[model samples]
Target: MGGQVPSKLTEKFDPHRLVMRGTQAYQPRCIALEGSVGVTTRCSIHPQRPSICREVLPSWESGEPYPQCDKARIAHGLSPLAPEDWIRFKDANASAA
Candidate 1:
């Protein structure tokens, strides 16, 4: 099978999981400019930072500020969307044994 090659840019863009912390413990959510926890220097996932990072302006669209990336969905009054939801949806149509 022939397909286009994936560039380094493609490998560094993940839309799914957000990278919270690397191997370090007790890292602050917001970091200093020059310290080890700085935004430009000590990011947990420096390479794969998502595009949505810039679009997260606090209270721009509403009075509530933009929450952390992990809780983005829940902040919008939606559930975490667990896989169990799909299982339950499937079981609704399942025949009795």
Candidate 2:
């Protein structure tokens, strides 16, 4: 929706729906054909992001990381968090909080 739509999908896809109604009722679209996900995986509209986005917390605070974050890291060849990592993360952020 932000960039030029692929010619192949032009006939079958509705770019408007992908861009305007991609996220509905708290469900987010994967492709972000909406352009909400930025190049670095941060929300493009972070300052004005939805309530659900604001409610998500990293593992350190919640005691368990988001499964999707862990899955993505593993898919990219990174290790999942060890107990020590969580301990350190909690220690580091505890003071900030």
Candidate 3:
């Protein structure tokens, strides 16, 4: 078996460069994405989510600003997460070095 990893680029990818399902493509909310957009949200089929859902991680999770997170938030009239939004998760001694 070839032990080579597949390239991330190919046709059937969006401008954000994510592979989207036919119905979810260009649609703000995905069939897999459940719950309210602004108030609360969760992936119903997280274990079997599409490539787009897997690729587009939350900003705090990847430690980089993910525009999809912000876009979704704004679309539902919710503010984008602030840099300090994840402060609660910080270690107590992280800044005491």
Candidate 4:
């Protein structure tokens, strides 16, 4: 679930719904989210998270910008992610492996 690239066949963990849970009324968050929403966060079920979760971010891996990703980060008082962030993450993950 935590991999940068999930396989086509197993990319989605949707049973037709999202596990939305909001700590604040202003925004809806995922129940599987861990750590802080804006400052630092990771999915508790990264491997099994829904496809929407994986693709909703500014998908530099796919060469697409999803406004929703930056919007959510801004709402949470976090800076938007750049492609370099993704690159760093990918590199770190590769090193970890």
Which portions of model 1 show Cα errors greater than 4 Å? Answer: 1-72, 93-97
Candidate 1: tens digits of C-alpha lDDT, residues 17-55:
333232123533432113432112343333344444445
Q: Could you say which candidate leads in TM-score?
A: 4
Model 2: what TM-score?
A: 0.36
**Candidate 4: regions farther than 4 A off:** 1-19, 23-28, 45-55
The C-alpha local distance difference test score for the whole of candidate 3 amounts to: 0.58
Off-target runs (Cα >4 Å) in candidate 3 are 1-28, 89-97
Could you tally the backbone clashes for each prediction?
0, 0, 0, 2
Clashes of 4: 2
Q: Write the per-residue lDDT of candidate 3 for residues 2-95, one digit (tens) a residue.
A: 2121333222456655433334356544545567766677866566565545676676654678899888678778887766767754654477
Per-prediction TM-score to the true structure, in the order listed = 0.21, 0.36, 0.55, 0.55
Which of the numbered candidates is closest to the native, going by highest lDDT? Answer: 4
The model with the greater TM-score, 2 or 3, is 3
Give the alpha carbon lDDT tens digit for every residue of 29-86 in model 4: 6556789855578877676766567667563655666789878768778777778888
lDDT of each: 0.38, 0.49, 0.58, 0.63
Rate residue 4 of model 3 by lDDT: 23
